[model samples]
Target: MEAPPVTSMPVTGGAVNMMEYLLQGSVLDQALESLLHRLRGLSDNMDPETFTDHELVYLLKGQQGNPFILRARRSLSHPTSPWHLRYLGQPEVGDKSRHALVRNCVDVAASHSLPEFLNEMGFRMDHEFTANGHIFRKGVMKIVVSKLSRILVPGNTENTERLSLSYLVELSVLAPAGQDTVSEDMRSFAEQLKPLVHLEKIDPSKQRH
Candidate 1:
């Protein structure tokens, strides 16, 4: 059977403009277990979900400015789940009082043929990686603790190399724009995990140079 062609739609059209609030930090491999244990205690009552995802980042270049980027992620462990397609704008330059980095973002669930469709739309695959992690949620906030691996071959997910001896920790929330209160809650939650993992707002742009 042939999969349906994926089409792009406006994800930011609604009345409520959505933004992603994010705080990022990392922990050494030896301390990953301890951080996970602490997260279990601080997270919601639901069982923590584990996932192994293969993610590909695609770039679309235009005549001007930086190329637009998109991330397509699929769960390797749960093949039946739909693929996640995400568009993340650059980090916002807000006041120092904001606890987390804020960015305009959109997430869409796509069919299995997403890669083919994206290729047809002129998006070039920039890079690929595997992320296996435990996910935790508290209210609207989401926490992901994952170790990233470099794909050894272009299309082989089985052959990979661990990127580093550390696990990347991300604390994120998707909420309406201008909701600075969300950052406050994230900061408070991050405090609880302190000494274990220190989550802070990191701007990717600043790290480029």
Candidate 2:
């Protein structure tokens, strides 16, 4: 069976439920600098946060339903920081009234033993990659601009090749389940990035052939 639903996993010790509102787009390598400059001015005043992370996708197969998937990510630049484990459900794209795609999301901070723990729980590694990016925040909204690299040798994060000549951009906010207002904020922020990058609620499920 799948591990557990977001509501069951108490990452935050409360009765409230959380959901992830997301918008995604991409910027060509040449346009990255300008986008970064714009984001720096628009985002929070703290120093820019840049990161290098190695991420592994793990899957646990079941007799019925889609395979349970989990992402295990650890920072290469800040090795001392805790690893991040995230579970994101399928995006809800049918609601045209909403400005952003909403999905169930559970985030947990884990120790370096994350991989071993997942394996012990019968999860298999599906793929791995390295992401180098800058993170920005405006209120509860979080934005990430990242370039992905395909790991060449298994388990070797150092030996990787660029996946594309563009950087993937994501604007997201984790808020309580009923907060539709957060999508308005996301849409407004996306407008600020207009022409530079067109962020939209692209359904990943539809893209799968």
Best by lDDT: 2
Cα lDDT tens digits for candidate 1, 19-126: 889999999999999999999999999978998999999999999988989999999999999999998876764557889987778888999999999999999999
Error of 2 at 160 (Å): 0.7
Query: Which ranges in model 1 have alpha carbons more than 4 Å from their true place?
Result: 1-15
Question: Residue-wise lDDT of candidate 2 within 1-209, one digit each (tens)?
Answer: 33343334444543556799999999999999999999999999989999999999999998898899999999999899999999877667777788998888888899999999999999999999999999999999999999999999999988999999999999999998868899999999999998999999998978789
Model 1 global lDDT (CA atoms, 0 to 1): 0.88
- Which residue pairs in model 1 clash with each other? none
